[model samples]
Target chain A: MSGWVKIAGLGPGNEALVTPEVTAALAEATDVVGYIPYVARVAERPGLTLHASDNRVEIDRSQHALRMAAEGKRVVVVSSGDPGVFAMAAAVFEALENGPDTWREIPVEVLPGITAMLAAAARAGAPLGHDFCAINLSDNLKPWAVIEKRLRLVAQADFAMAFYNPRSKSRPEGFVKTLEILRQECEPERLILFARAVSRPDEAIRIATLAEATPDMADMQTVVIVGSSLTRVIDRPIGPIVYTPRSTPE
Target chain B: MSGWVKIAGLGPGNEALVTPEVTAALAEATDVVGYIPYVARVAERPGLTLHASDNRVEIDRSQHALRMAAEGKRVVVVSSGDPGVFAMAAAVFEALENGPDTWREIPVEVLPGITAMLAAAARAGAPLGHDFCAINLSDNLKPWAVIEKRLRLVAQADFAMAFYNPRSKSRPEGFVKTLEILRQECEPERLILFARAVSRPDEAIRIATLAEATPDMADMQTVVIVGSSLTRVIDRPIGPIVYTPRSTPE
Candidate 1:
């Protein structure tokens, strides 16, 4: 059996989005590792052994999988979105890079999948037209200091930004401060797009503004998109959407 | 017979990357509207009507499709990437907005397709890890003044940027001037990525510097990504993919 680890993109929790190429790779693996919800997307296959855990403990789980792969297991790691976009592909690589050199020989293949940002953009029409950035608010593995630096960077660029891991109860001040910092660099009337439970039926997406979005309007599943300078509010009956471009090059 | 437009994304021109959902959407539509090459991706669909044109006349084809839809014809508008991301969706809406208001109620649906930026990033292995921006070199719709203003914003933001439509026979000077503007706010060593034909059969994605990427290295099909303060170049077998994020935060 191939001992290398394969990182598969499950694609926004919908099995329909999983490509045959990716499914064939997963079917050949002996073990799969992922967050509990993501692992469940595959249902069950006879040859696969699933290792699941809470979302907060991703690093530990990823490290465990890497160890197993190092020991000659055909491991398939799973992520809801494309593995590299804020997913386990990076975690697995980081753990390998920072640890022993013996695991360097372990081949890692990253399969692409759809991300929540694009899904929300698809639902709303064209919020991601201009230059955009995605930042996570969960300050777990990274320091708040670094996150603040990135947020400021995002605002200064005036990029349409989608914020993931925005709030979890313990991180109550997540939105208030980030929005304040963003408002300093961007306009107050700028649109802020929120998408919760995207693609899983009962999916809701809304476009509001910094002055309009309240803390009561957000939760863990929500993705907050702060519009760039050109973001506009349309009068379509299905509510409003924010539109930005890749860039406004001179 | 119902005439609806289903805008599909043909990822970087590779048939394998086009999702099944998009394929099904194409199957349901009678007429397909897009640039000549993009329509060729799904040409073999049985009982399908194909309306293809040169790149210069894409907007005209989109308008024609909307007209067909307005006449109760089920049409599908095809864009190589996501329809909303600088593709055909806006042109269709622009036509609807400029014409009769009755067309607004035509039950228009924008599906999420894989963007070239993400497709390029995936092929490059995590280049867009942190804050990034995308800009188009084409200035047909946007004025040069706006492009310069946005370029300054990109520099001050220190954003990792991907440049779309960087060069054409008409606008060879645009990329050069943009580089000069970017150098004003960033270091000379910043990695500038050029991804041409990503995920396509003849795909080519290269990482260079703003100074290094000349007009010789780019054309209409190129997608250039410029590095941020955090982006680091990793040497791999293919080439260097500039990565920004070190690890996923808690």
Candidate 2:
């Protein structure tokens, strides 16, 4: 049998949000590799072997997946949300680029899924309906300065912003600094949405203004969406809908 | 029977990319409303009505969907990609905000799907694996100035950039101006990926440097991805893989 590597996204948390392409890839895979929770999402079929590793060991995980594929094993690298977005696709490619030239012959494909920001935005009524930027707030790999620069520039450009890994136990101060930068660049009344465990049963979405947003509102599971200056709130008998208008006036 | 509306994304032209959540919404929908091509993707079934309208009539279509939903019809407002991302979700919200107060009583849910940018990024490798911004290049709804300003700022920020609606028959000059702005803000060797009809039978993906890119390379169906300064290409005997690294060194 020929070896191949498929980097597939499992979507946010809902099985319903996963694409059929990803499902088919999982079904054909002999080995699945991912972070613990993501690997746990895959079923334990008779022909499949699962490799669940801890976070922050992405390179190690990628090398393992590639080695297995090089050994003629059908490997699927699972990622929550789209693998191409701050996920396993890049890591797998990074490993491939730096690894043996012989590994280049293996077939690789990326299967897209419903990313977190899109899932959160949908649940919150499309605050990202207009132009938007997505940033990973964790400074583990990138400098905080880079994150700060992007935040200020994105706010100046008036793009709705989505932040992943906004807050974690190891780096609790990152999101606080993010909020401070947003407050400096945007108005106090600017809208923000904190969507936690999106598309899952424990999903919680909260809409707040810049003035009312606190650092505690975000955790590792949360996706923080900051609206542009033009975002609006439509109050209904059910609840308020937050959306950025499709058009911006001259 | 009560009425409800579900805003669903059909994914980027592939039946396999469509989420089961969206498929379920379409299955239960008594009426499907969207642009001509998107509506054509839905299968014909008895007791189901498909409202296929021309482009640029988003608000009218949205209002029509909402009205039908208010009148006891299970309506699904379909967008080609994720409804919340430059598609029907905001238009429907805008109509709801401006329409009769009674329209607020209708239950609405936005089901996310694989967006064009993600699908394109997947096919081309992970060009959007790092921080990225998505911009609509069409000047129909927004002013040309806003688009120009965003282009400059996004390049200055060094975020991987994705462009939707890059070129249309009516405004071919928009992409020309975009390429010009990108040339001014970025380096000559910066990479750009033009993915057309992504995830479809006729899908085409081309990777070029900013200096080599031309306005004629894009069309309304294309999603243009411009890589950040840190983006790299892994060349193999088969083809090249483009990806933005997960880390940015201080």
Candidate 3:
């Protein structure tokens, strides 16, 4: 059997959001590998062997999947959102780049999924309807200074912003400092959305101004979207619909 | 029957990338409305009417969809990719904001899909694995100055950029100016990916450095991705894989 590895996105905690391509890949795989929760999302089938590892072991998981594919086992690496965005696809490519030459010969494909930011943005009208930037606020992989610099620059550019991994138990101060920087660079009326567990049963979406936003509102599950200066909120009997207008006047 | 509007993304030229949620919305839709090519993608069925409009008639199409929905028709407003990003969701919301007060009472939902940038990035590699910004390079809705300012600021901030509507027959000069601004702010050897007709049968993906790139390489069908300074490429017998590393040195 010619074995291959497919890196697939499961979407943001919603089965309906998972593409048929990803579901087909899962059905064909002999081995599934990813973080514990992501792997748990895949069902247990007779022919499939599940390998669920802890967080921060992305490289190790990638190597394992690649090795399995080399040994003629069809491997599927699962990610919570799109694999190309801050997920397993990069780690798999990194593994292939540094690992044995034989690994490169193993065919790998990235099946795109509906990412968390998009899911969150959809749930909250279209706060990211115009030009936007997505930044990973967790300072674990990159320096905190880099995040701060990008935040200030994006604010200056008047781009709506999406933040991933906003606040964690260990690094709660990152989001605190993020709010502080936004307050310094943007107006007090700037709209910010806190969407937690988006697309899941317990999904909570809160739209608040910069003055009303606090750090504790965001957790690891939350994706925080900050609107540009021109983003507007239309009050309705149903709910307030927040969207950035398509046109920008000269 | 009560009326509703569902804004859906069809994914970048591939049926497999469309989510079950979007597929369900289409199945339940009494009318499908969108730009010509996008509306043509929907299969004709009994009781299902597809409203194909010209490229620049987003507001007209949106108002039509809303009116139909208000008349107790289930309407699906389709965009080629995720509707919230440089697409029809904002336009629909804009229409609703300015239209009759009764329009606010209609149920509306945004179903996310595999956006063009994510699909393009997946095709190339994970060039957008790190922080990235999505910009609509066409100056149709916004002034050239705003696009220019954003190009400069994103380059300075070192965010990988995904350019939607990079060039059109009428606005050929916008992409030309974009290249010039990129040259001014970025290094000569920075990698850029031009993914045209992504995931389609005739899909073409090309990777070139900023120095090697030209204005003619892009068109309306293409999504251009410019790598950050830290992005890397791994060459193989098959093709080159481009990705941005997850870490930055202090």
Best by DockQ: 2
As a whole number from 0 to 100, the lDDT of residue B243 in candidate 1 is: 62
* Residues A1-250, model 3: lDDT tens digits: 3889999999999999999999999999999999999999999989999999999999999999999999999999999989988899999998999999988888888889999999999988888999999999989988999999999999999999999999999998999999999999999999999999999999999999999999999999999999999999999999999999999988
TM-score of each: 0.89, 0.99, 0.99
Q: What is the TM-score of chain A in candidate 3?
A: 0.99
Model 2 stretches with alpha carbons more than 4 Å out: none
Tens-place lDDT digits, model 2, residues A1-250: 3989999999999999989999999999999999999999998999999999999899999999999999999999999999998889999999999999988999999999889999999988989999999999999999999999999998999999999999999999999999999999999999999999998999999999999999999999999999999999999889989999999998
Q: Reference contacts recovered by each candidate, as fractions?
A: 0.32, 0.91, 0.84
Q: Which prediction has the highest lDDT against the true structure? A: 2
Model 1 chain B worst lDDT window (10 residues): B233-242
- Among all windows of ten consecutive residues in candidate 3 chain B, which has the lowest summed lDDT? B232-241
lDDT string, candidate 2, B136-192, tens digits: 998999999999999999899999999999999999899999999998999999999
- After superposition, the stretches of candidate 3 with alpha carbons farther than 4 Å from their true spots are none
lDDT of 1 by residue, A1-250 (tens): 2487777777775565665557877878878888888887765778779888888676687688878887878888888867767777666656655567666666767767777777777777667765567777777666787678777766765667778778878888977778778768777788887888777777888777878878756678887777777776555554443455433544
Candidates ranked, most accurate by lDDT first: 2, 3, 1
| Model 3 error, position B78 (Å) | 0.8
Record all residue pairs in model 2 with backbone atoms less than 3 Å apart, i.e. clashing: none
